[model samples]
Target: MSEPTPDAPSGPPFAVPITVRGYETDTQGHLNQSVYLQYAEHARWSLLKAAGIGQQDLVGHGVGPVALETTIRYLKELRAGDETVMSCRFRWGTGKTFRIEQTLTTADGTVAAEVAAVGGLLDLTERRLIKDPGGFLRELAADPGLLDR
Candidate 1:
């Protein structure tokens, strides 16, 4: 990734707007359970994009992100045609892992779901967790501040 431009977005809680699609719904007409995770994943990638980090950037560095665990709380039903926003935020600690918190909210401000995940950067060659995932991400990000809380 290159350096952040003067107009790059700043800080955390990166958001991506979405519209629930008919194909993403279950027989019950609510969003599929697994799709919530997909939405969260999309938001995370969008955040990376916003920070000017691309898959090649991480791959070239021999580093890739992995999700160790994820938990989701379904708060409300999301049907097809519902406009929503998926937001992502990263919370880093002292080690190789970090916490990813995300929320799926409807346009009317209803929170449809919340997702929390444990993630880390993997060293492709070694197939081991990177010693400092946050540091590695910061190095890859054009707007490092976007990773900050």
Candidate 2:
């Protein structure tokens, strides 16, 4: 599928909104289970971009990032016309990977879902993890904190 039509308030806080179309809903009318993952991913990417970190930032700097692992928890239902606000937080980041927390909340601030991801940066040319690129590692080290900090 293309993607949900991201509503202005339906996207994550740091994320750019995307439209969630009717096609994303199944017979039950709630968003499809698989589509929920897409929503979370979109919010994560938007968060990274807002953080001044993005695909180009990694590529031009010769670094790549990937999801080493992910954990998700679905808390509530999101029907059509429901406005959601995704919240992407930098949980932790380091030399080789980034750990982020993504929450899809309603406009009222009630949470709909929670997603946690651990992403690793890679030097694609060398097919190995990128531990340090410019001052990227240092910046990540100085990031606030997270679930485990």
Candidate 3:
């Protein structure tokens, strides 16, 4: 797995750098479309890790994140050996659900794609969306400010 690298200190959105791999490319020599989602997912997890929250932490809390909807806007194409940066930003409103915005940009500052998703914390046992997801995240996050919109 790739390590998380912060592009800025004390920010609303957290970013991680990713280097495209040969195996991740499509037959057309471009990054696979599905891999974009994986990149965004990695960024989200890395953000949680940076906030001192881990998968176990969420599981211990009886909650896990679930994506309700996702939309991707593709711009430039990425190929193997390309170095890109993926960013994750959480937008918390007053509810059990939240919105996450992410962007993938090549090393030359070209925007490869943009991803927007609606997600929520799920109660593992109850198998439903948990109430006060943001509050729960804030309670678990070492730096609650990082979750602020």
Candidate 4:
């Protein structure tokens, strides 16, 4: 597969480096497809943490992020010992739903996979989706550097 150009849009602003472990790979010596989704999930949580959102905050607001849908494209294969940088960004959608775009790139900048997920804040007590009552999306939109960590 062709690697994305340096000038290409780099998905999200925040990145977390990860090293592929033998347990994460399949008998084919490549990363398991399910693991890519796990990586994306990890990156999203990291992004939220960097933006000052955490489990405690969610619990305090009686809301938590829930993924409504997810789609992933595998571009290249990752073997054990490969180092990758996973990045994530947020995009608002209708109502309480928002989109998260994540990319996993190899040390040499080859994109191994891309994941897009539809998520929203779920009212833990009400068991339903809720609008941005805490201004999380607003804060994210206003500050591009919020997820720079």
Candidate 5:
């Protein structure tokens, strides 16, 4: 595990520890580009799970999280056997949309990748985006400071 960086965001972050697998690397022995996205996705889902939300919970509410856009920046190479931490934070956006920021960091705290995603609630039954997501999502999108600590 890595110590939080000085610039790390306030409030508690949802973190998942991961080890780079050989299959996730490339010829150059660094983590594949696509794997970074996978790490971010895992971090996001882990965050939701830590907040008492899960796939079944979303399905039961007839809603799911749909990513509208994502941007990732590769900072350092991660090789097989490298232990790292993936951390995620959520911030509100316009209307129903919210932003998720995730980081892949080395065991010693060196950042390997940074990802920013824009997403919103999707109404599964309606098969459409929800401009005004329900209380569950709205509460999740709210600032952590406003939530019970």
Candidate 6:
């Protein structure tokens, strides 16, 4: 198994901007913690697009990976008017899963949140875990070479 590397990325990591609407906040005047997870989801999809992987392709191939688990570490609180740049890197697991390690950062440079997700390859037609598509798995495995350790 290729180890999960600790990478300090050059740019925003998976830096994407988000506008915090009033409703997304709690009485504390900061973005509700739950909202940060939502932001990470968007960034994950964007990474797939960047990787030329799409939901359609997974379903059409009769295979899919579901977000079976996640871990989120909150570093700093964010409020309205703050823009966040989040970066995500795809991880291919030796076990039965794939993972994404994501970091959300403030515009200037501060970790707002960290998200780690575990998803497993599924035989969607049978609704069970299965070996991933070899070609696609290779692509994800190849991704870490692009990371900065």
lDDT of 3 by residue, 28-115 (tens): 9999999999999999999898888999999998989999999999999899999999988887766778788899999988999999
TM-score of each: 0.91, 0.71, 0.90, 0.82, 0.82, 0.77
Over the stretch 23-113, how does candidate 1's per-residue lDDT look in tens digits?
9999999999999999999999988888889999999999889999999999999999999999988887777788888899999889999
Enumerate clash totals for all models, in the order shown. Answer: 0, 11, 0, 0, 0, 5
Q: Give each model's whole-structure lDDT.
A: 0.86, 0.62, 0.86, 0.75, 0.75, 0.69
lDDT of 4 by residue, 1-149 (tens): 12222234334468899999999999899999999988998988877776667778778868778988999999998999999999887665335676677889999999989898888888899999887432553454334345322
Q: How many Å off is the CA of 17 in candidate 3?
A: 0.2
Instruction: Give the better candidate number (1 or 5) by lDDT.
Output: 1
The reply for model 3, stretches above 4 Å from the true place, is 1-12
In the range 3-92, model 5's lDDT, one tens digit per residue, is 223244556667899999999999999999999988888887777666667788778888888989999999998999999999887765
- Candidate 1 structure, TM-score to reference: 0.91
Deviation in angstroms for 125 in model 5?
A: 2.1
Judged by lDDT against the true structure, how good is candidate 5? 0.75
TM-score of 6: 0.77
Give the per-residue lDDT of model 2 (tens digit) for 1-149.
12112121232235444445788888999877887778877776665555556677668767676778888888988777777766665443335555667778777777788888877767778988776332453354323111121
TM-score quality measure for candidate 5: 0.82
Say what the RMSD of model 2 is.
Answer: 9.5
Better candidate by TM-score, 2 or 3 = 3
Best by TM-score: 1
Question: Which residue window of length 10 is worst by lDDT in model 3?
Answer: 1-10
